[model samples]
Target: MKSFAEIRRIAIARKGEHELAARMPGPPERPLRDLSDDRVLAEFSRRIFQTGLSWKVVDGKWPGFEAAFHRFDIARNAMMSDDDLDAHLRDTGIVRHGAKILSVRDNAIFLGDLARAHGSAARFLADWPATDAMGLYDLLGRCGARLGGMTGPYALRVLGYDGPLLSKSVVAALNMAGALDGAATSKAARVRAQEAFNTWHEESGVPYAVISRTLALAVPD
Candidate 1:
């Protein structure tokens, strides 16, 4: 097995030769003024979560989700009446996967309670320690939230989050750090790649975030 430094050096050498594209426009730098509005945040999260899914599948149906779930009002979602939810299942516009939809509702309610207990959802999320790729995958798997995998997490990283969101840029940083094997094939290999890259950045005094962004710039569209 290669030492972490060796992996980083290999990754840097294999950094996709194509010129990087412009950064995709990400969320705003500052939180919205009414950041506490759960409904809006839920909407944003929903939209983001739906990215890889067909928009046609989620667009017209979103209103149904909005209406059926009390506009995703955290308080209301927590207090959702079973009868109301049953009625919502009958709606034609929404995705009919009961479990998945319910998961969203449950997550909303859970997040709401967490916020109330922790003072703010942002703060609560921020308190969670940053993790490498494998750690993030495990966390998401344990949470039972749908649609999150390596690619999904990478997208989340690009989308930005209250907590560290790993991105391709981070992957690049990992590569720079000697964390990745240029020949990596599986998800586990990719994760090892990230660890190597991060270790390199930490020891080299290179700002990981800057390295990530710079590496992101090297990725082709």
Candidate 2:
């Protein structure tokens, strides 16, 4: 694998120092532990609905979603009645996809279950070690509805969860770096990939997100 220094140098040459600094993300303004559960669920729902659709349309209708879903209060959504769901299916305020709408209630319950098991959903997400991002991703896939693929990671990222998302560029860079033999399609491959990111984190003193973006920037699209 190329040293992270080498990768950083390539990214710097590609984008230049000033532009890269401006474009690269930093630590979120609020720590993950301080975030409200409602906000976490809200972002999750937003990403869930945004999948395979125009993000612009989703953002424009987010207020309507907020109103329809009671601002994504976990307890409230966990208790959303069948009638409430039926009403939302017909409501023009938000996307009318039945499955995605159902996921809102289901994931709310998932969060409530987390709260019961670990004090609160926020605490559970905030406390998961960032180095084991793959584990966290698996946990969400098992426990939360509609959180498979990048949905869970993307939502967690919005709430300050620092981890690398396996975007196409990132996966390509990982392959080029010899992190794994190919796409991280198997459990062992993903775990190996996570270890690679962990090693870079220790070596560079940069968060996984930073390393991830650096890798993406270093490689050709």
Candidate 3:
């Protein structure tokens, strides 16, 4: 495995190379403020939730998803009729997997309930205490939320959550922080990754959004 320094060197070397430009998908250049709308936030979460699926597929089918899910209106989706769900499952543009679609709807309902209980999703998430890796993994397991892995936490980090999120971007950020070697593999890698993030935030004079964009673009599909 390459050391964190080695990975950084590779990343720096590839930064402006024509070949890399051709191969690397650039992150969306739009400012994070543009993505702060509730609808946009829902879409962003949906995209991340659809990780295993191709972005091309997701983008192309987004219209179908939007129509099917009432444009992802949390309140409306929470009360979706069975006919609505059936129609969604029948739609060819979006992923028609029954369970996956159901999960989306279920998550919406759950999110609504959470909001009602906690006041707001943002507040709920914010109020949730910061946690370490094992703690996060356990929480996900308890929630019966599928598709989240160690990488899920990192994804949250890149998404700008104040608390822990274990996703690849976090891993890369960790390497940049020198908390973990780029190639380092261990349970403690996550903790080290968090430390690295803190350091980068302090020294790089760059915002998390920029760092996230850089990291997202660096990832190979």
Candidate 4:
């Protein structure tokens, strides 16, 4: 793998320093403010609902979603009766997809369970090491409903966790760097990819989020 310095230089040339800086994820000191178990579940729900759908549409209807789901309060949403979910089927304000709606309730249950097991969902996420992003993703896949694929990491990003997300651009950059054979989807591949990022973090003394953004910016869109 190319040194992070070399990769960052290439990214600066390709995207310009200003643009690259803008695209970079925030430092750890700046938390994704107002994060709570409920908000985390809300962001997870947002990502799940946006899958294979128009993000624009989903974003525009977010208020309705907050209202419909009681702002994704973990306890309230976990207790969402079958009738409540059924009511959303006809609610035009938000997306009417049945499976996604069900996933929200499922995810709420997941978060509630986590709270019971580990104080709160926020504490669990806050305590996880950003360097082990793949490990955290694995945990999310197991404990959180419908948090497979990129959804888990993307949700983490949205919730202000400073970690690497295997976004398309980042994955392409990793492939170019010979970090892995292809997309790092399988468990073994993901583990290898996470180790690469950890190495970069060690080399640069930079946060994983910044290293991830730098690598992504190094690649052409």
All predictions: root-mean-square deviation over Cα?
5.8, 1.0, 5.9, 1.8
Instruction: TM-score for candidate 4, please give it.
Output: 0.93
TM-score of 1: 0.60
User: Tens digits of per-residue lDDT for model 1 on 45-76?
Assistant: 46544655786778757777677666677776
- Name the best candidate (by TM-score): 2
Residue-level lDDT tens digits of model 2 in 1-221 = 77788888988988887876787778888988888888889989999999999999999999999999999999999998989989999999999999999899999999888889988788889889988999999999988999989899988888899988888888888888878788886899899989999989989998888898988887886
lDDT of each: 0.52, 0.89, 0.53, 0.86
Ten-residue region with minimum lDDT total, candidate 3: 31-40
Off by over 4 Å in 2: none
lDDT of 3 by residue, 25-112 (tens): 3344443233323453354346554677776877777777777776777777667678877887788877887777766666576557
Error of 2 at 200 (Å): 0.5
lDDT tens per residue, model 4, 54-172:
89999999999999999888888888787998899989999999988988888989988878998888778877887787888998898778898889888887677877988888889
Instruction: Compute the lDDT of residue 82 as modeled in candidate 2.
Output: 89
Q: lDDT, candidate 2, residue 198?
A: 91
* Model 3, position 72: C-alpha lDDT score: 76
